[model samples]
Target: MERPLKGSAPNADDEQLLRGRVYGRDHDDPDPGPLPHQTYAALVGGPLDGLLLDITGWRTEEVDDGVALITELGRWPGGRALYDPRSGEPRTPGPGVSCRFYYSGDTP
Candidate 1:
């Protein structure tokens, strides 16, 4: 039987089947089940340019505040690469992209 599309509402039977069990590729099975959709933020103009940040389950305020990424470019080894939201309001660079972040600077 064909599997339901990702993100489609799960019916009672589907819910029951999924309850209390992790679904994915098992040691014996090579075929992994359908993967869920994910949200991401695109990083631009920095050491981490072109990297996608997984923003699944993140709050709006948290995304706007931006994030500090660990990179070798920091003051010391494994330092931080800071990034800020490109805009005060959220803007999607493309499909499946929740927002875009611009390089701010690096920190120790």
Candidate 2:
């Protein structure tokens, strides 16, 4: 489902789902780690130049153009979904999106 606008207050259900995704629970995956790599897909509009999406650490900020998602560039996991272009996962990165891996600077 499409996410609510940046400044929009999520409904109870939406908020609950967001919380579950962020914090994880018996149903969802745990916090993917401090510096987990991820793919950033633009749900609406086009991509911005020089923008990096670090899956592990990211935040949605409102800019004059709307919402801006910022992330860092890092190493990609080996054959993992984090950076795989085609992992066959239901939520694999989509079109007009970019992917990057991250490192938390902690020993695994």
RMSD of each candidate?
15.6, 17.1
What lDDT does candidate 2 reach at residue 15? 39
Query: Candidate 2 — which pairs collide?
Result: 54-71
Model 1, span 1-108: residue lDDT tens: 233443233344544443322222232444322324756666675555655676767777798789997754334446677888866655654336677788887777
Residue 50 CA displacement from its true place in model 1, Å:
0.7
For model 1 the TM-score comes to: 0.58
Badly placed stretches (over 4 Å) of model 2 are 1-8, 22-67, 70-108
For each candidate, the alpha-carbon lDDT, in order, equals: 0.58, 0.28
Best by TM-score: 1
- Score candidate 2 by TM-score against the native: 0.20
lDDT value, residue 12 of candidate 1: 47
Residue 14, model 1: lDDT of 43
Report the lDDT tens digits of candidate 2 across residue range 34-104. Answer: 22344353222111122233332333221112222221211221111121222332334332234322221
